[model samples]
Target: MNFGTKAVHAGVTPDPSTGAIMTPIYQTSTYVQESPAKHKGYAYARGANPTRNALQKSIAALEDGKFGICFSSGMGATDAVIKLLAPGDEVITSNDLYGGSYRMFRKIYEKFGIKFHFIDLTDVNNITPFLNEKTKLLWLETPSNPLMRITDIKALTTIAKKNNMLVAVDNTFASPYLQNPLALGADIVMHSVTKYLEWP
Candidate 1:
């Protein structure tokens, strides 16, 4: 399907009761249930909401990813990816990426015992020396936050995959319209929806 079509219908379904074409924003703390543990797929507002689910589904479809997760902020999404690692696990990331990401990784996750290597990832070879058994993930942000450094997604993913590491890309700057990192072999693609997306 074309991008325009996927953008509209990928994760969306007509409202069952109202038959509204677009996904509705369900504004409530808790959903009504038929019985104990028997709700319409939504239990708590913080846990899951129909609107957020639809958005996540649409973004995932656009990125060609199998699954999607929505978070409160870009840092929240970054935190989720970091949580995938163990205490001693290492991540090699682009030095030119977002400052908030660097703060989250160094200030927050570092205290948790996760190691990070912030290096210039403009050329794929610059990352070679950082590879090791402790390196569990490859983090990237391209058309990087302020620097506009473009890392070759396919080349990086290829190397990371060869070493059995997961590759994650922050596609906020590029957005799904410009690039699909998942299609380029990235294990995960993250976006700061507050920017390009109006639904924050």
Candidate 2:
């Protein structure tokens, strides 16, 4: 299906009980069960929700990704990605990217010992100088925040893969309709749903 068709129908199914055409807002914090071991796929709001599951599926389909995980905010999703690294691991990213992401890298994760190299990514060759065994991830933001600089995703991801580094692209600025980083060889792709998609 095209983006428009997938956007509307990809992960949603009609409610069998009410025959509602859209996934209903599962507002309750918990679900009922026949027994302690038998229940529908949710336990608590913090863990999962039917409404969120539908949204995740729609996003995954849009990105041509295997799965999608929703977060309260874009930063929350970013924090989850960074948590994959341990102390002493490193990341390479563009200096022209999002300010919130920059602050999160420099202020929050740096103290945790995850070193980030902020450089000019417009010239993909600039990333070569920072390549090292310590680098565990390559983060990219195309049509980047504020400056709106574009980075060549396929070119940079190719180089990153050669070094065995996982590549992640913050696609909030470009949106899935404009670019799908996973198809370009990024291991992970992130989006702030509130930005272009405009829904949780």
Candidate 3:
């Protein structure tokens, strides 16, 4: 299906109980089970919810990715990505990225020993001096927050991959409708759905 169709129906199904056209909002925090250990896919709202699952499916479909995971906020998503690294690992990212992300990198993770190199990713070559065995991730924010500077996702991913670095793009500005970073060789793609992907 095309983008328009996928946006409407990709990860959604008619309500099985009521035959409702869209997945109903599953508002309960807990699910009833036949036994203490037996239940359908969902058990707790904190763990999973049908509504959120549908949204994740739609997002993954739009991005041409195999899976998508939702977070309470964009920073939550970024934190999860950064947690994939250990102390002494390094990340190379655009200096023009979202302010909240910058602060998180500097204040929170830096103290943990994950060095962040904030550089002009718009030139791609600026990333070279930072490349090394310790560099584990290449983070990009296309049409970067505030400044609206566009980074060359494919070009940067190519160089990053050569050095065995995982690439992640914060696609909030461009959104999946305009750009699919995974297709450009990024290992991960993140979106603040409350931004461009918000339902009308």
Candidate 4:
């Protein structure tokens, strides 16, 4: 299917109950079961929410990724990624960082001992000097927030792969319609889904 068609239909299953074309929100905080362990996939809101699942699946498909994870906010998603690293781990990212991302790194994670190196990532080779044994992830933001600097995701991911590091691209600026970092060798793609995700 084309991008437009995929955007409209990917990950959307016909509603089993009402036959609605789009996935309906499963809004309840709790689900009842016949027994303690026997029930539909959902058990609680905190663990699994069908509405969130549908949205996540949709975004994943849109980004050409196999699976997707959603968060309460963009910062929550970034926090989850940061939590995957240990105290001595390092991250190399664009100097034109998003405000929320900067806060997460400087105010929150830095105190925990994770070091961050922010540099001009416009030229992929510029990252070579910053690469080191402690590096765990390369966080890139294309069409970066505020200033809108575009980083080459494919080039950066290639270098990251050689060093055995994970590459995550903040796709909030381009959105899935404009670019897909997963298809370009990025391990993870993030979208804020707050500004450009228009709803009918």
What candidate 2 gets wrong by more than 4 Å, as runs, is 197-200
**What TM-score, over all chains together, does every model reach?**
0.94, 0.96, 0.96, 0.95
Candidate 2: C-alpha RMSD after superposition: 2.1
Per-residue lDDT of model 4, residues 77-115, tens digit only: 889888989999999998998899998998999999999
Candidate 3, after superposition: displacement of residue 106 in Å? 0.6
Model 3 lDDT tens row, 1-200: 98888888898988777998898988989988889869887789999898999889888999999999999999999999999999999999988889999999999999999999999988978988899999999999998999999989999999999999999999998988888899999999998877885433
Clashing pairs in 1: none
The TM-score obtained by model 1 is: 0.94
lDDT of each: 0.90, 0.92, 0.91, 0.88
Model 4: residues >4 Å from true position, as ranges? 197-200
If ranked by lDDT, best first, what sequence of candidates would result?
2, 3, 1, 4
For candidate 4, the TM-score is 0.95
RMSD of each: 2.4, 2.1, 1.7, 1.8
TM-score, candidate number 2: 0.96
Worst 10 residues of 1 by lDDT: 191-200
Better of 2 and 4 by TM-score: 2
The 10-residue segment with the lowest total lDDT in model 2 = 191-200
Candidate 2 lDDT over 1-200, as tens digits, reads 99889999999999766989999998979877788958787787888898999999999999999999999999999999999999999999998978889999999999999999999999999999899999999999998998999999999999999999999999998898888899999999998878985433
